[model samples]
Target: MTAAASSAGIRLRDHPAFILFWISRVCSALAFQMLGVVVGWLVYSLTGSAAALGLVGLAQFLPILCLTLLVGHVADTFDRRRIVLACQTLSALTVGALALAEGSGHAGLLPIYAAVVTIGASRAFEAPTMAALLPRLVPGEVLPRALAVASSAMQMATIAGPAVGGFAYIFGPAVPLTLAAVCYGVAAVAMAFIRHVHAPGPRSAMTLETLLSGLAFIRRSPVVLGSISLDLFAVLLGGVTALLPIYAGEILHVGTQGLGALRAAPAVGAVLMSIVLVRRPPTRQVGHVMFAAVAVFGLATVVFSLSSSFLLSLGALFVLGAADNVSVVIRSSLVQLSTPDEMRGRVSAVNSLFVGTSNQLGEFESGMVAALIGAVGAGVVGGVGTLMVVALWTRLFPALFHVDAMPVKVETRR
Candidate 1:
């Protein structure tokens, strides 16, 4: 490594709170990723229906949709660390319940959905708290690099989690679920060690106007709105992850191990890309880069959808992930930096809603389409839709396209 990069690494490592935060995030991500693999496979194995897979996504998303505004308010009004600790504990307990259900051989779709709903509620609270907490852990100048490091850790966990879960399935379906519970437990413990203390904001009365503030802010900020919505539409249109089980069994004929490989490919690419970004952060035309990267993501999705060969599919997924990492780093930095400190929690919650819509709702869309046509047809159509979205979004949000650097200053109306 260059002397500058080496010195920066030393600085990052010297911060105990960031280290602890990073550890907690990695453990939590690993647990969630493992739980995802187990849930998707088990749901499919039992029902043998594509729509059932979509239901799993819906089950997790409903709570977020219902409680996101309230959750954002809580994050801003309370101690962010405490909120994370409580939510992590809740997630651990939910996963433990899932493990018990599986071990008892009484695991049904209904019970699984119920457990996922509980986990989803935990996520709805946890996401904004964590996003709001990050800027407090590190200096403002290094926030972009800090975000990159955090993303790398998450991608690393993503790479390992599914592979471990898929292999653990050999012992029994419940084994991965049990392991996921253990990871969440570890994550909770790590979160408990974080000593960063954020003063609670003045509490506001619960009201419709207060809850809508986050939405109102995003509506007025063209940069934030454009970046968030671009991701929302692109991923909603192009997401093929919900169909991995089908691809593993029907299209690719690769079984469980191959399913694990398919899931990990994107993360592998993301981790590599994140490392590069951390060393040499984006300097100019960041908005353009994000747009181009997303377009590349759509193209990669198209290639993956058309490929029948395992190696070819993996390559496409790797490219897709690499492109996604670029968009993620840029968008996350932009959202956090542009919004004021007091409003970070609310804004982050709004951001999370966009994410949930893209991921969970996208899964539902993918499943319904796949059920009607076929997996390949759904993938092709989604990829095309994603490209079309890029063209439309570019036309609609010129401010997003013209942004020149990270840590952009935007005028916000309070």
Candidate 2:
């Protein structure tokens, strides 16, 4: 496809590869979410310890941290689609084994932890490769819409997957694991169908210099550093998700059902915002807009912390989700456009690392703070901290703050 053929006014659905991309993404996302719900339940039920539950997060996070640089090189050097497919296939088989173990009443903590580690190791390869593959599926101009649409699908899966897992577990633990295996299998097959265009210019030998190159690139590029760090700090401090159960039970006086609604509210808002972006994409001043969205997310967190009315809290979460989608759409597109294709995988790996670290730590931070000052106070403080991040980042990285156009062709070294 030529550049002109893929200019503005082109919908992502017009591209066959882009369609397959999202199908694969949604399926893999659903599988992961479903697996998470089932695994958390199994580990907790077996050990009955919150610390054991925390270990599960550690099992998942560690491989990504240890393999970040190496995997980025792999994505840049090898076929991304094949890597993603292989990883998901491994995940499917591993989760299927878990299902078998559960059916035989042999799902012990050691086996479960081993399985979680294997799945996590696969995703360590899969996530960055998949991210690097996306720009290849669609033209640069349509990437914003593409990211927005993918985010919408992922959020939908995020909302539904756990519910499906919870319901499937009623049949047996194996039932949900089996379902997750099917989803992973489907995701692998969908990825097999993608015909994305990737041109690897050259390969370099494995060395300390090559491995740390992504970090070097980020440090040198203020726009890259600023956008990603903004996400890291803002989300690290702004998250109140871990405290949702407390709010639903004590403050809002709603039960488990209300907690479900509160959890789904952000996704609902995100999906709606994605639809709007698809229709009318952002045209200008996106940096300011992204900062504004983060601000809104913070404000919503604050309002949600203070509100006693269930309805009011729901509204806050809804707006919070919508605003977050806007920032995500902008930030993801900008980062992709800024990087050269050869190292997109490496850069994307670093990007994935930042995101994963923030989310995990965010939950830990929220839980600890809530324990100390109570959930309400923690939410208020977190929201304020997010606002502070936004304020400081604007002055810190003027390039990111002043960004007007969506596309940036960055120059990088070998």
Candidate 3:
């Protein structure tokens, strides 16, 4: 590690713990991406409606949202590693169950929904634990780079998963479900290899007051509050992932394969951006960059709404993904660096809530809007709404606008 980099914080490459953690995270991410494409295809095929797709998203996200506070509290007070292991085991079982159900040829809507709900419950526990554990695995200085790496891996997975899932669906829906089970099984094994990680600090006491402390912590931190809110609003209004099936089947005249391509498009852009971000970190005015990126994301969505050609729509979504990734990197780095170690899990739980909202709620918004106004019109309106949100956020979050990326200096463990 360079002396300058060391003085700034831990170098990501030099740390054994960080390397292992990164690898495990990447493997899990690839598995997750494959699972998503398969699940989406399964749901849509069964119901033949965009609203049904939104329901799928809702079932996955609702548990995460509802249990976030408890999840965060548990993360802060307990053994994070054990928490992760338990959740991973639960996740693997759910995936296996999904595979079994699909294979049986008797997989009803309720059964699928039940499996997803179990997966959702697992995530409610896992997300905060995983995010909080990253800092322990890596030195503070290279945290941003580490985050970039993890996000990039996820993007790559996104690129591969849907493409694979589409092909699997061609053979049989059961094929994709079984593949997802295998992926989750691999992820579970990979997680088991992590060792020697320390737990979070001891908790004072378990009480209703302690459970609510994470929320209280956010209320006092303007930077955290503003950044979280900015992400929530921008994504909620602008995201159109839920409506892709509608666009795919009706407007674009593309089949399941095309839908997979549509899903892969953003991840392609995100992966490309992640690679670039690795070499050239964002400048000091990250907040400004965030807003510009989000605005561009919105504008791209608007363009996508108007595009009749499949290629043109893909190009627009690519741009949107590119912009959104930049936003994600910046916001996530800021969130991680700004919070105290003890509070990282709770803060991350809060982040999960916002992100989950952006995803599932965005899906709901897109689905309803498409039902009411037509898919194309709904996307256009959502994009415009996103742009307005960016303008409002600029006015509201001066700190976020001016905050520069800092080298994460890990204070020596107590």
Best candidate (score: TM-score): 2
> In model 3, where do residues sit more than 4 Å from their true spots?
1-13, 37-55, 97-111, 169-175, 249-257, 410-413
Ranking by lDDT: 2, 1, 3
Q: Which ten-residue region of model 3 has the weakest summed lDDT?
A: 1-10
For every model shown, the clashing-pair count is 0, 0, 3
lDDT of 2: 0.88
Lowest lDDT sum, 10 consecutive residues, model 1, at 1-10
Each model's TM-score, in the order given? 0.88, 0.95, 0.88
How large is the C-alpha RMSD of every model relative to the true structure? Answer: 3.4, 3.1, 3.7
Clashing residue pairs in candidate 1 (N, C-alpha, C atoms within 3 angstroms): none
Q: Model 2, residue 410: displacement in angstroms?
A: 9.6
Instruction: Please give the distance, in angstroms, between residue 11's alpha carbon in candidate 3 and its true position after superposition.
Output: 8.2
Task: State the lDDT of candidate 2 residue by residue for 155-224, as single tens digits.
Answer: 8898989999999999989999999999999989988988746755467798999888989988999988
Question: How many pairs of residues in model 1 come into backbone collision?
Answer: 0
Residue range 216-235, candidate 3, lDDT tens digits: 88888777787788889888
Q: Cα lDDT of model 3 overall?
A: 0.78
**Alpha carbon lDDT of each predicted model:** 0.86, 0.88, 0.78
lDDT of 1 by residue, 369-405 (tens): 9999999999989998999988888899999998997
Candidate 3 has what TM-score? 0.88
- Runs in model 2 with CA error above 4 Å? 1-13, 408-414
Candidate 1 wrongly placed segments (more than 4 Å): 1-13, 39-54, 97-112, 169-175, 243-257, 370-377, 408-414
